[model samples]
Target: MNTSPRILVVEDDRTVRTVVNDYLSGQGFSVTAVDNGSEVLARFAAERPALVVLDRMLPGLSGDEVCRALRATSDVPIIMLTALDAVPDRIAGLESGADDYLAKPFALKELKLRIEALLRRSRQAGAAPSEFGLGPFRVDPARRHIRRDGVPIPLTTREYELFLYLLNNPGRTISRDEILREVWQWQFGDPSTVTVHIRRLREKIEEDPRFPVHLKTEWGSGYRFDLRGGEG
Candidate 1:
């Protein structure tokens, strides 16, 4: 079996698909290019791509639908390709559960960097402490899971990484730049991406996301994960 990380590139544009496939393959990845979104899952099962490069628009199932479907099954990292670089569109893409997003006309070099970053995080060894819990929450890195009060809480790859990072450093305010550097391994990236994932994680762990108890925003300083949930 080829152990090289496989990448599933889902894009309808022939030129774009070819360029991405050639570039990524040249970068030492095993890439399988497929056009239609409808065939994504089948390719996913067969190719077992470590990451998915999904175009926002597709012929059959649509990229958002494919992304949702993939999230339902696996936490494999997904990078969305959007023609429009509007904030709302990127927000919608992340909300749909894409691990990352790249606007059209983006530099392939940047795309390569994003893929490398997410892959590095994903491939990190799972030898964290046997268990961790804050209040009703607990994480088993070996099992790749988190639980609240012994009940499992489903989290995507990025969310789990973010949560783990927060748990590893309790009480301190973590800035978006710091998070992007530490968690996402990005020297530079859009801060809103961190904001969106944090909000998503808060929804899963907090009693009230609007009045977040665990993941607290430190006004302009970024966010802090309060272990006590600010009860003290």
Candidate 2:
């Protein structure tokens, strides 16, 4: 029985793809490498990999497009690789359904570490049967699903992790640095990543994102998630 976790690598660059595939395989993962974006969905459907390492530029359907398509039906973690190193480009990748992003010329060791972290989190979330309530919302961690007032609330993989982290530690202010370290499992990275995810969470959880109540920013500190919202 080959029980090793499967990883799908999507990169147009042959050298990068081959290197990543070999590296991940050496790291004890079962890797499937693809060169074109168009093949991503088919491979995903067939393999149902534990994670996907996708390049932003590809021969067919761009990375963003493939990401969006995958997100429509699955919450499998995606790490986007791109040549664009600007803050906005990273943010755009996250917005396009990537759970994490790495720029071109990245260290292979860091990529491996991130893959381990995401896979660990995914396994933990799935194996644990945690059901809880936050105000009107119901969280089922085992299923990676949440609902409010009988309606399902859609959340990206990162958003769900962030929400659950806050819910588990209620009332205490969680610093963005702590969030990056804990939720993202990154010792250092753009704080804006946390900011972007928090904003997206507020939109889905708050009655009015413009004046959020449950997920409150502590100005110079960080954020706190509450069960009840203040009066509008």
Cα lDDT listed for each candidate: 0.88, 0.88
Compared with the true structure, what per-residue lDDT tens digits does model 1 show for residues 47-93?
A: 78889999999998989999999998898999999998888889889
Model 2 vs. true fold: TM: 0.91
Candidate 2 collision pairs: none
Minimal lDDT window, size 10, model 2: 223-232
In the range 58-83, model 2's lDDT, one tens digit per residue, is 87799999999999999899999999
| Candidate with the greatest TM-score versus the true structure | 2
Query: In model 1, which range of ten residues has the least summed lDDT?
Result: 123-132
| RMSD of each predicted structure | 2.0, 1.9
Error of 1 at 23 (Å): 1.8
The list of candidate 2 runs beyond 4 A from truth reads 126-130
